[model samples]
Target chain A: MQPVLQWENVSFAYDGRFEINALSYVIEQGDFTLFFGPNGAGKTTLFKLAVGLLKPAIGRVVLGERPLSEWKTLEIAKYVAYLEQEAQYIFPFTVEEIVLMGRFPHTASQFWDRKEDLEVVAWAMEITGILRFAKRSIFQLSSGERRKVEIARALCQKPKILLLDEPTNFLDVRQQVELFETLERLNREERITIGVISHQLSLAKNFVKSAIFIQGGSVGSAGPPEAMLTPEKMSEFFGLNVSKVSVL
Target chain B: MNIMNASNSNVIARSPEGTTKQSQIQRLLRPQLGSRLAMTTGISPGKLVLIIVFFVAILFVTFLVSLLSGAAHVEWGTSEGQFILMQLRLPRTLLAFLVGMALSLAGAVFQALLRNPLADPHLLGVSAGGALGVVVGSGFLIAGSFVLAIPVLSLLGSLAAVMVVYRFSLRKGALSLYTLLLIGVVMNSLFISVIVLVQSLVRSDELTTVLFWLLGNLSFASYPRLFAISVIIFTAAWFLLRQARKLNILSFGESTAHSLGVPIERTKKIIFLVASLLTGIAVSMSGMIGFVGLIVPHLARLLFGSDYRKLLPTSAVLGGIVLILSDSLARVIVIPQELPVGVVTAFLGAPFFIYLLKRQEAKRVI
Candidate 1:
């Protein structure tokens, strides 16, 4: 099967400064991958490039066999949904309304939300455990709940691939596990490819099928978590002594 | 751990309790219903229609009151009263309503586009641009009525001024809110200085009309003139509301909206032009009424939340109601010699603006 996304010798610059240089990775269909790195490792930048929000200065990213740059944005949005690390709002919109925004690419007409749109939104919220808070103001939501709402919104997009950045930031330990478990189920049942940028290696290691260690704006290594994240490799890449332990 | 997860799942499974399809009367009778209902299901199509009806009803009441309470007391039963109502009060009231609709709706769009609550055409240099254009076009006025020339000139000026400020504010072809606002102020000052310099050169007779217009009010509304602007205002407002969902996405943030397939640059430009057009039209009709554009949209968001589909119409209605009431107060407060409606709205709106500013500061602190 074709890879869901492919990047070859990709480089990106911000303000004419090269932040990412000669990076490449491939995300396969229905694969769960974690992009692991320290702060400023360019994981967020990689995600943006993958989703076509940012363009590579040197090379190209292909989504579903087509270069991302060639696809129309709305068409690309239908295939890949992205969730931000932190969400902010200037207006007091409801949780339901925020979730419904995921159906934006699927909107059938001008300013109209079809019944199917509502149904998908409701299902996404329900799965994310935010359905009951559907009527509550997003402002009134706790940070953890707000993160779930963001996840629900991404899910509402019903994309083939999901990209989440720091999605577990505000979630509790159990919610963290549940979120990964949910993503695992989506990968298994819906065949939705998932890419997560995360800090909690301990929580995500079991759920992710593959892991990439990003350092100095390039992929240090990419493979199964056990194969690529050895203690020696981690210690060398992080410039700190590291150890690995089996918790279960 | 699994058991606790199960329990938390159970907690989340709780159904939406005791809130659905709240009636308008019920909302009035039960104050908490406002927050409860506004937050849920957003607003249904039927509910939006009902809200529109409710505002239209309020508009009608205000219209009657405004017609009845003007400087001269004329009985509605008599021919003289009918003439007064038709000739003076009716046109003024309609003009006020249209201006209110245009300004407030534009305000809602501007706030969403700029993602700043304080954004308004008056504050962002669009209205000043319109006023500058009006001053330049002051030579063409026929007995205090602009007919249509001022609106056309003013629309181009408003669009130009905003584009200039917007271009200056761009950091790599994207707007920085702070810079946009800063340049807007500078542009406004420049436009005002130019207006003053031009005013010094024009005839004293033309100067009086320009001065009254700069303050902004409905005192100069005429029937044919009001009708012409109304066509533009309503059409522009309809176009805006059709783009409601796009506006909603844009308000979340530019990058976020872009991820969801919003053509960010195009949408922003469209909103900027639409908002500027509306501002130009309103200013040409009623001059630069400062607070309506700044406050009415915020008021709509407060009352109806920020779903632009609902917020836009709600702001339009509430704006009309607020302006009609303000104009009525303007007419009656000083008796025979009416105060400009702008004065009345500013007196009412400035404190509210400050309160919102303080609240925003408090939010930042927290």
Candidate 2:
């Protein structure tokens, strides 16, 4: 199968400081991948490039066999969804309405949601376990619930590739595992490609099938969990000790 | 476990109705009436009728009170009273109502687009821009006949101001709230200073006229000119209400809107221009009336909820009510010497604004 996304010698800079330098990676179709890095290690920058929110300074970022710049913004949105970390909203939109906004790219009119849009929204909310809170104010929900709502919103867009930045930030241990399990279910059943930016190094090995370890604006390694997350490699990338805990 | 296994097919495959569990719409059980109404559709037909009836009843009473209680005393039965009602008070009240509607609707939309309840024409420097245009281009209206020239120049000025402020405030195509407000304050002062300098340069005979223009009032609008201003204000307001969904989408956050395929930069520019045009119309018609936008929009949100489709028109009506009441208060407060309507609005609006800011600050501290 063709790679769903590729970055070929991509380099990006902000205020003369390079964020992503000469980075190359190929994410195959149906891959549940972790984009693991320390803070400011260009994980978010790469995600922005993949979603066409930002353009690279040097090389091309490719999505589905075409250059990122070739697609219209709405067209790219239809194919890829990017959820920012801590998606804060101003208005008191109810859960259903917030989820329905994800279908904005699919409809002809910006205002009206069609039947299919409503159905998709219902399903998205249902899957995310927020169908019960459809009428409740999003502001009233806890951070973990709000994060779930955000995930439901991204799901309603019907994206082929869902790129989330800091998906596990506010989630507790159980919620974090549940989130990954949910995404894993979606990845297995729907074939939606997942590229999540996460700093939770220990959890990525248990939940994700593969990970891309990035350090100093370059991909240090890319492979399955056991191969890429060895203790020495973990120490090298994160400067931390890792020991296996054996269960009796 | 059951939900996890059953939903595993992943084509969004389960039929909404056939499923044993209730769909979201059916499961909605919010306690508040407005929220419950908001849950079903943007505006329920029954509630819309209720809103219309309430607004019409209140509007009729306010209109009657405004027409009958002006300083020029004539019995309601007399021809003299009829003349005042038809000629003087009627037009003034209508202009007040129209200006109020324009400013409030603009405020409502601006608040939505900027995602800040504090967004207003006066605070955003739009009114100062319009005032600048009037001060510098004094005879643009040609011997004070209430033509379209003033509104046109004012619109141009307001749009320019918004553009300048927007460009300065933009950080990566989004307006940060602090930066935008700070620049707006600086630009307002800058533009007002220019207006003062222009007033000094003008012939001494025109100084009172400039002063009257600076201190907003509603007494000068003729019926014919009121008709023209009405068309412009309503047409612009209608155009804005038509984009209600876009405003709703925008209020969430620019990135969310963008991720949902909204062209962020273009939407921002269009909304900014329309909102500025409304401010210019309000300014040109009746100098810089403060707080109609600030007060009326929050009132509308209280009644109509946050959905812009319902909120915009409701704000327009409530805005009219507030301004008509304020203008009437300006007329009858001291019994003879009429207050500048803008002064009354500021007096009413500033306290409420400070209160809102205080509440916002308290919330942050909490």
Candidate 3:
């Protein structure tokens, strides 16, 4: 498979401090990759760079062999869907309405949702298991349900590559597994590239095909999960004894 | 289909086609609450039509009532009555309606732009800026005789306020809503102080005029002035309606909006400029009328949904209705001695604001 997202010698800094330094990684089509590191190791920042929320100070971010800077925001959004760590909405938009917003990149210039857009939203909601609560207010739902609504929204984007930042952050263990399983299905069945930044190392190891361990704003190692997430590598990257890392 | 099999554990017999069929049947069985059309426009065309018609009729009735009942009852057939209706009452009522429409639309826009329910045109220092402009602009003129200069100067003042508030609140390339709100509070207090200082320096003979104007009066509106202001208000209203979808997306917060391909910075700037123009022009036309902007949009949101497409127009019409009714009450409430319409609005609006806060507090518990 061809590379769907490539970060070539990418570097980024915030307020005179480096958050990412000369990092290079490639996520090929239909690849399910997990990025994990200690807090503030710039996993989230790497996602930001991939989505062009932040521009790399050095080198380039490329999608489909084209430089990211050459694409408009709408075009980039169509190709890659980015889900932030938190979901915030000020108004009482319905679950369906919020998910329908995922079709925005496609229907931005239109005054209203088209028939095809509605169908896609319905299909998206169905896959994400949120069709039952389609008419309910997002604020009324539990946190796990809300996360599904967010995933449903991302699915509606019909993206080639999906980047989720801590999709399982607030979820219980069961919910986290269910979310990852759904994501794995998308990666396999829909053939969409998936990159996720997560802390659930032991849990995520079951779903992800490959792993990229980040340390001190750089890629410490990347390979198949079995090799890359060994106890030796975990201790080195997280600065903890393998026995103390219970989550792993 | 495979994902559904792997993850969905519910006993409900379902397939992709089954879900589609169920939704189709549900759509048929469901009572139409205008939601079919609301799917795209936020409000159904039929409901919007009915609402517009109902409000238009109410607005017409209020116009006639205000035209005939104020202090002096004027017969429709008599020439003297015709003179009072056409010359004095008609312009006043129309101006009130226009000002109401402008303020309410501006308020709705501000609330959405700031993502705060409490946001209003007056809260952002635009009205205060206009008031300061009027006080200072009129000071340079031969006190009570300058009609045109008041509006010109007030518009300039408000635009300047918009510039300052917008400039200072911007960070790098994006707007910081937190900073924007704080700067608005600061600018309002600072501008109000300048207005009071200007008020102190005025001649005693001119003091009452400035004070009455400051308290908000619609008696100064004439046919020519109304005609000029109406063009601007309508144009701005049309522009706002076109921006409904962007505003809807913006309610999700700037970062999400950006990820969804919305140029949040550009949208915010355009909305800010247009909303400020509406507020500035309303203030210039009729001194500083408070509460109409704050109260009308909230009432509209309650009556209608929060969709900007529906909310903006509804707020405009409802605003016109509220202001017309309030102006009429101000005319006849005490007979022969007119109360400033602003006082009546504040009197009505403050209680409602308190009620809203109480309701919100109650909602938070849930």
Give fnat for candidates 1, 2 and onward, in order.
0.45, 0.35, 0.28
Q: For candidate 3, what is the DockQ?
A: 0.41
Q: How accurate locally, in lDDT, is each candidate? A: 0.80, 0.77, 0.82
lDDT (10s digit) by residue, model 1, range A1-248: 56988888999999777768899888989789999888887999998998777889999999998999899878888899888788788887888889989888878255655555676775676667676777777777777788888878888788999999988987889878878888887789778899999978877888999999988789988889877666676666676645453322
Q: Across residues B1-366, which tens digit of lDDT does each residue of candidate 3 receive?
A: 433332332223143334666556434423221233234333346667998999889888988788876888777699998899899998999999999999999998888789887788888898888888777777678854766677888888898898899899999977788898899989999999987887677565555676787788898889999999999999999999988878877887876777788877789988988998999999998888999998898888767767787889999999998999999999888998899999999999999988876775575411
| Candidates ranked by lDDT | 3, 1, 2
What pairs collide in candidate 1?
none
Instruction: Give the higher-DockQ candidate: 2 or 3.
Output: 3
| Superposed Cα deviation of residue A203, candidate 3 (Å) | 2.2
Per-residue lDDT of model 1, residues B119-171, tens digit only: 88677788888888878777766754654465666777787787788789878
Candidate 1 regions exceeding 4 Å error are A170-175, A243-248, B1-12, B15-43, B75-79, B136-153, B169-179, B193-205, B352-366
Question: How far in Å is the alpha carbon of B13 misplaced in model 1?
Answer: 2.5
* TM-score of each prediction: 0.87, 0.85, 0.90
Tens digit of lDDT per residue, candidate 2, span B1-366? 433432342222233443534433333411222232234644445666788899999999999889877788877779987888888988888998899999998888878777787777687788898878766666544564433466666667887888888889889776565687789889999999998787767765445665776677887778877888788888888788767777877886776777778777777777777787778778878888888888888767655667787888899999999999999999999888888888888898888767755764564410
Model 3 Cα lDDT, one tens digit per residue, A32-53: 9999888899998998888788
Query: Mind sharing the TM-score for model 3?
Result: 0.90
Cα error of candidate 3 at position B334, Å:
2.1
Give DockQ: model 2: 0.40
